[model samples]
Target chain A: MKLIGYFRSGASYRVRIALNVKGIKVEHAFRHLRKGEQKSDDYLKINPQGLVPSLLLDDGTVLTQSIAIMEWLDETHPQPPLLPKDPVNRAKVRAFALAVSCDIHPVQNLGPLNKLAAFGIDQANVTRWAKEVNFDGLQACEALIAAEKGPFCFGDTPTMADICLVPQLVNARRFGADISGFKRILEAEAACLKLPAFADAVPEKQPDAE
Target chain B: MKLIGYFRSGASYRVRIALNVKGIKVEHAFRHLRKGEQKSDDYLKINPQGLVPSLLLDDGTVLTQSIAIMEWLDETHPQPPLLPKDPVNRAKVRAFALAVSCDIHPVQNLGPLNKLAAFGIDQANVTRWAKEVNFDGLQACEALIAAEKGPFCFGDTPTMADICLVPQLVNARRFGADISGFKRILEAEAACLKLPAFADAVPEKQPDAE
Candidate 1:
């Protein structure tokens, strides 16, 4: 398997943590997103959305969408399961992941932020836009996970929710979003950082980190 | 079972189609999004994200996120399966769904569009922003499903991909996007509309539609 990704992409970061936690080794390929490499014809053929973190299987099948790829990985490799056994619990975990993936990340993504520039949003204000968006969603995420017993998002062990949360928190901080009020999230992030899977998948630790 | 949603929300529309297709008779509850009912204290207790299309199970377990709720419904009721049995195909269907859910819808959602006002975009430009974003995504979705044997998005059957596609196309047309070039998509939409599941889930057909 091979993974094509950019170092700073939170979606790619989610997959990297999942691969490490599942102990699945795949070759790495870089798409320097800031340089517009991902939109090139070669990469577009691999992922028509021109997004990062597409997983290429040995069978030549390519999987886009980080959540789908992570779910595929969990299904194909059962150990260190990313989802719980019960259906409802699985839905809860997925909802948590989607809260970040759908509500937070996509709105604050580089594509949308760049689009804001066309609306005459200057650089500093663009960062503010990203941070404010991240803040609102992460607050909801904090409340969602508050009732769960967690060293991670759901329990003592990390699941897909934690995999998604860690990277998103990293992104929130990068944009100068004040996360001090999200105690449960901070606790979960600290617990996840204790694991090599989470720690090693940090953006600065990736091979293509600028 | 019950579902809480607004009439015209694309995410809500996806779950309604799934319930109808699966033959599950869940009670319906409407939250008038334009009136800010979804963010009511009562509703937020059920869903921290306060997004529509939350499924309330008989066990009183609330399921949020349209895809997660649909997957749970599919898992609990296997008849007329929404996804294929093969992992690769399932991933394919999911990727198609996320191409719209993650890439297009959230960025153009009311929350983000309202935020654009703070960035000094007027109502006409806001509509233009939403339409342009929808156009770009639907075009990619058109290319992604082009190779498939699709009266629906995948094969002849209306899998999760079609479930997502139909509503997104509805939204695109509402936003005045020129979707004439997406031949395959229009064909799939026509095929899906022939089914009562798809036809009945249209925005105008909903009980809460204005």
Candidate 2:
């Protein structure tokens, strides 16, 4: 398998953590997102969305979307499962993950941020936009997991929720989003970072890091 | 089971389709998103994300995120499956679904659009932002499924991909996106609308729709 990603992409960072958690090894490839390499024709052929963290199976099938790729890994390599066994619990874990991947990350990521800049919203407001979106989403995430007895997001082990939360927290810090009030989320993050799987998947540790 | 949703919310519409597909009957409730009802204290207790399409199970478990709720529904009631039996095919279907739910819908939805308006981007430009994001996303969605001989996104049946696409196409038309060129997507949309499951989930048909 060959995993195509960029070091700084939160989505790519997500798949890297999943791979590490499952102890799966694969060839690594990079797309320089800053240079718009993901939009190149060749990359588009592999992933029509031209997004990072596409997993290319040995049979030549390419899986796009970090959430889907992570689920696929969990299904194919079931040991150290990234989700809970019960149906409702699994739903809870997935809901937390999507809150980050869909609601929070999309608005704060490069595409929308750059679009905000293009609208003559100055750098200060653009930065503010990122921070506000991150802070709002992370607050909701904190509430979502408020009831769980978690060193992780759900339980003792890090589920997909932690896999997702860790990366978005990294982005939160990057945008200077004031996440200090999110005590539960910060606790989950601290717990996840203790493991090598999550630690090793940090953006700075990736081969493509600048 | 009771489903709390707003009629016009695309995410809410998604879970409705899944319920209709699986033949699961549930009590229905609404949170008027435009009136800021989703943010009301009571609603937030059910869903901290303050998003529509929250499913409240009989035992009082609140399942948030349309994708997770749909997956949970599928898992608990497997007949008339919303995903393929094979893992690879399941991943492809989910990837396509997330392409809409995460990438296209979030950026164009009420939250981001209202934020852009708050940035002093005029309504006309804000509308343009919606159109551009929707068109770009739908184009990628078309290309993503270009290889499959699909009436639905994956096969003869409407998978989660088709469930996601139907509502998004509604938003696209609302934004006046030039979707006339997406032949495959239009074809899939046509196929999906032929089924009552998809047809019944339309925004206008919902009880709470203005």
Candidate 3:
């Protein structure tokens, strides 16, 4: 498999963590997102959505969407499972993941942020917008997992929830979202980063990092 | 089971379609999204995210996030499966679903649009923002499924992809995103709506549509 990604992309960071957890080795490729290489024709053929973290399989099948790729990876490589075995627990884990993937990430993504700038929302407000988005979404995420006893989002081990949460917290901090109030989330992030899998997947550690 | 949802919420509508597809009947409740009823203290207790389409199970287990709920539903009641049996095919179906759920719908959701307005983007530009989000997202969705010989998004049966697609099209048209050029998407929409599961779940048909 050849994993196509950008260093700073939360979605790409997600797949990298999953790959590391499963101890799977795959070829790596980079798309310079800041330069808009992901929107190029060649990249579009691999992922029509022009997003990074597309997994190109040895059989030549390309998989897009980080959550879907992670699901497929979990299914195909079940060791150190990223999700719990029970139906309800799986839903909880997935819900937590989506809290980051669907709710938090997309609004502050490069595409929408750039669109805001194009509409002449000044850089300050655009930055404010990203900060607010991160803060608000992370607040909800913090509350969602408040009941769980966790060094991780769900339990002692890292699941998909923590996989998603770690990267998003990285993003939240980048936008200066002031996530200091999110104790549970910060605790989970600390637990995750202690492991080589999560530590190694940080944006700065990736081969594509500028 | 009880489903707490607003009729016009795309996330809620996706679950409604999934429920109808699975032939599961549940008690229905509404949170008037426009009135901010979903953010009520009582509602937030059920869902910390305070989002719609939360499925409350019989034992008082509340499941949030429509995609996760749908996956749980598929797992617990797997007669007419929402995902294909094959891992690769399942990935394909899920990627298509995420294209709408993660990429398209959230950007144009009430929260972000209202935030844009608060940032002093005029109402007309807010509408334009929604329109472009729909148009760009649907265009990519169209391309994502271009290779399929689909009456549905995959082969014959309606998978999670079709469930996600139909609601997003409703949202896209609501925003006046001109989808006339998206041939494959339109075809898939036509195929999906022909089924009562999809048609009956339309916002206008729901009890709280007003």
lDDT of 1 by residue, A1-210 (tens): 999998999999999999999998999999998899989998999898999989999999999999989878887898999999888999999999998998999999989999989878899999999999999999999999999997788998899999989989878999999999998899999999999998888999988887
Candidates 1 onward: DockQ, in order: 0.82, 0.91, 0.92
TM-score of chain B of 1: 0.98
User: Candidate 1 chain A, which ten residues in sequence have the lowest lDDT sum?
Assistant: A69-78
TM-score of chain A of each: 0.98, 0.98, 0.99
Docking class of 3: high
Q: Candidate 3's residue-wise lDDT over B2-112, tens digit each?
A: 999999999999999999999999999999999999999999898988889899999999999999999999999997899999999999999999988999899999999
The list of candidate 3 runs beyond 4 A from truth reads none
Which docking category, incorrect, acceptable, medium or high, applies to candidate 1?
A: high
Docking class of 2: high
TM-score of each: 0.98, 0.99, 0.99
Question: Candidate order by DockQ, highest to lowest?
Answer: 3, 2, 1
Ranked by lDDT, top first: 3, 2, 1
lDDT of 1 at B150: 70
Between which residue pairs do clashes occur in model 1?
none
Residue A1 accuracy (lDDT) in model 3: 93
